[model samples]
Target: MMQLSVAIGDYDRNRPLIDGRAKIDGVDPIVMTLTPEEMFFRAMRHEAFDICELSLSSHTLRTARGDAPYIAVPAFVSRAFRHTGIIVRADSGITEPSQLKGRRVGIPEWQLTANVWIRALLQDEYGVAPQDIQWVRGGLEEAGRVEKVKLDLPDGVRIEEIGATDTLRDMLADGRIDAFMGPRAPTTFVPSNKGLRWLFADPTAEAMAYYEKTKIFPIMHVIGIRKALAEQHPWLPMAVYKAFAQSKAIALEHLSETSATKITLPFVEEQLRRAISLMGRDFWPYGVGPNRHVLEYFTASHHRQSLSARMVAIEELFHPSTLETYVI
Candidate 1:
């Protein structure tokens, strides 16, 4: 069996594989549970892992440049609607998305998947273009954050980088930045901090409505295998895909047990039912065909945002072997 080092986030859907309950057919995976920050930086900068959960935006950018180091498998390890990521100062007067024009907004990185989705939605749904805001880039809570990959921003889109002493949380708290957006809420967004609030008062409703119209949950991360390993062992991608699918299945099956909740959340059953009612049984799908629209939209957004030179097709991103599966 080929020994492969894999870097991925620790989530319930991937827990089975991480704990050795679900096994890949022909490979021995040395799973290293790492935060997305560490994993992405290492993978993109150093080719540190044989397999990794890569940011969809960065991966798409690399694919467009024809220099991607990893072949993606259609296993979407992370997906979320990014409406909740946008946080604004209560006094900013940014009650609506349209109000954000010419205002200062801070983000952890320009190429972050969450930021990419948020920017896309702002333009597509509200007609607020990227050039409309002065973007401030820096860490959310800590200091010394930088974009994992170099960016080629479009003209008229101004981006300012914060020094190592600055953070988005402080900037927002001190009224230095008008708003902030990222995957996680900043430390200053708690109830005690009356200064900050979500840009959308009720982000869940906004997200649901957006999903109803666009049918995109916004895929964040894709499972990637080193290109050399994938080329040397063509079957490796399928094996990884099957294992991740099985792991997700196991997690879903456990989540379906309503007698006692598997998760700590009180409304797991209601949330599960709501998800099914809204999207369908396989709402968090893992294959290419089921997710073509999402992939297309994201890649198009990547190109439009100037992160990619051209829009990368869905077929160009994922390994062909994992695109189709037997329906026995």
Candidate 2:
């Protein structure tokens, strides 16, 4: 009976994680609700909770100069998740990356992966550097403060501290900014309500293109374990990953039943079905091998950003050396 404190997003994304089936199937569920910023804070502080699922963008915060030894999970396309995208006002004459020159772009947080990846894409593919565009950070108001995430920004980006999502929405609606960077759900909702057009969406095909070209898997989430504890209980890592994979399989089987039983907000059956289609069986594996592309990308990016001067051996990041690796 492992007392695992696995961090998950808000209620909407966490419903499936806390089901009785998980507990019965061997995951002592202790739930914590926090934004990505807060999770970054907890990881930085090296909180006692075991097994944290954090965004790759927050990996910098987690492994900051003096943090505990933790393994980041590979960035994989979860069975039903999509990459973040840039949303622009439809009629604003901003239809492509080339038009973004001199226009303002908003990011939920400066440290967010979508923001950085999109920045890299803009620079690499379209000859747009950080200096060429107005980068506005939508985050907390206290100077240099976010929930738990800290950002060390490069030059040529502007910062506009916002306290909440509504403030960001107002800003977007008022034309204070030209475009915003965020996950699909958050960015699409407000703009759609206002009939604002999505200038472009980096769909799954685009994600596959980036990977095929760069071999960089945009890490979405990583699960870390305290090094000492992991040494003491070597089996924990595989067990945890196995549990999630199994639970996901169970979730897929009872897609309709799970929705009916839980009735959790916003995660209706239709969404589950879509997620099932998106996160195909291949993306979810019983062991570490399934997310190789994600791991490779993180290793390269970490080195590229000079976040780590040395490349990480993939084996060092996973538990149970014997677990066979596979890619989807």
Candidate 3:
């Protein structure tokens, strides 16, 4: 069996594959657990791993530029609604998304997948376009953060980097920036930093309503394999895809055990039932067809945000081997 290294975040759906309970056919994967920040930087800058979970926005930009070194699989390892990711200062007077116009906003990266979705939502739902606000880019808590890849921002949009001694968290806490957007809540958003509050007081309802209307759960990352490896071993992508699917299947099955809860959360069964009712039994689906609409929408958004020169077709993003498979 061929040996390869895979870098991905540890999550319930991928834990089985990482721990070896689910195996990829004819491949020996040396799994390296890493955070998304380290993993994306290493993969893009150094090609450090043979397989990795890649930011969909970055991957789309690379693909559009015709320089991506990996072929993506249909496995979506991370997905979340980003309405909750937007936070504002309690004194900023930015109570809604529309109020963000002409305000100073902080973001970890302009091309981050989460920020891409959030920007799209702000534009589509609230008529707040990217150029409407001044953007400040910097580290969330620490100084000296930079975008993993170069960006060519659209004309009329103003984005400036924070000073070497400054950070987004500190700036937001001190009212230097009116709002912040990224995947995680800022370190200053805790109770001690009472100045910070979510832009939407209750983002859950907004997220649910967005999902119910658009059917987009917002895919954050996609599985990527080195292009040479995929070319050399034509079957590798399918094997990896099947293994990931099986792992997620096992995780979903475990969630169905109502007799005793495996997680610490209260009312797990009730939450699961509510999710199924809202999104049907296959809420978290894998593969291309089930997620084509989301992919298309994100690609359009990426292009609109000036990350991609043009909209990339979903067919160009995934390997042919993993596109269609027998079911049963």
Candidate 4:
């Protein structure tokens, strides 16, 4: 068995893989639990790990250019609905998505996966196009952040950088930016009482409505294998896919153990039932076949948003070995 380094997040779904309950076949793996920001930066910039959780938007960008350092598997480690990504100044009076037009919106980076999905939501759902608003880019919590990958923006799509010392959290609080949009909410947000709040009065209701309408649970991160490693070891992709699928299956089984809730939060049973009713049994599937619509939709959004060189085909996104499965 070959020894390989794997860098992934510490989410419950991935715990099995991290702790050896699930193992990548034919490989002795060393795992590092890392933040998405750190993992993405190191992987994209330096090829720091043999396997890592990659930002979907960054991967798509490199794939479109035919220069991706990593060949992805269908293992989407992070999935979320981006409705709660946008937060507005409490006094801004922005009650709806449409109201975002002509306002200054702060984003940590334009090329972020969550930002791509949120922008897609605005354009496709509310007819609010990207160019319709002024985009201000800066760090969410700190200052002087930059895009992980260089962007090839479409005409009329522009992003202005904030000062070297400015942070989005501070800007939104001071009303310098009308709102902040990204996967992470600004620290200023306080439910029912706040100087900052979600643009939607009830983000959960909006996200539920969106899922019912579109049938897409936006994918945030994908598991990637170094291009050279996958090319040299032909079996690596399928092994990685199967292992991650097994890890997720374990998590699902644990989630169903309602007598002793595996998750830390309350109402696990109620939430699980609701999710199952909405998305069915294979709710958070990891394979390509079960998630082709999601893949197609995101690729379309990426190309349209000027993040990709072209509309990348879903088939071109993953290795062939991981694409098809033999059913028993």
lDDT of 4 by residue, 1-328 (tens): 9999999999989999999999999999999999998999999999999999999999998999898999999999999998889988879989998899999999998989999999989999999999999999989899978888888887998789999999988888788999999988876677755777788988889999999998999999999999999999999999999999999999889889888888788898999999999999888988888889998999999999988978898877788898898899
Error of 4 at 170 (Å): 0.6
Tell me the lDDT of candidate 4: 0.91
Per-candidate alpha-carbon RMSD to the true structure = 0.9, 5.3, 1.0, 1.1
| Cα lDDT, all candidates | 0.92, 0.57, 0.92, 0.91
Clashing residue pairs for model 2: 37-148, 73-222, 73-223, 79-279, 80-279, 90-197, 289-325, 289-326
lDDT digits (tens) for residues 272-323 of candidate 1: 9999999999989989988988888888888999999987888899999988
| C-alpha TM-score for every candidate | 0.98, 0.71, 0.98, 0.98
lDDT of candidate 3 over 107-226, digit per residue (tens): 989999999999999999999999999999999988999999889998889899999989998999888999999998886688777788899888989988999999998999999999
- RMSD (CA, Å), candidate 2 to true, equals 5.3
Q: In candidate 3, which residue ranges exceed 4 Å CA deviation?
A: none
lDDT of 2 at 9: 59
Candidate 4: regions farther than 4 A off: none
* Superposition-based RMSD of candidate 1 using all C-alpha atoms, in angstroms: 0.9
lDDT of 2 by residue, 1-328 (tens): 6666776554323345656454323457677756655665676566645767665655544444335356644323232223346777665688777898888776666655555566666776668776777767654222343434444445455565554453455566678778777653343356437646555564567666665575454555656666676678766666665555555666555545762555546757665565456555443443446556655665565545444435665665555532464459
Which pairs clash (backbone N, Cα, C closer than 3 Å) in model 3?
none
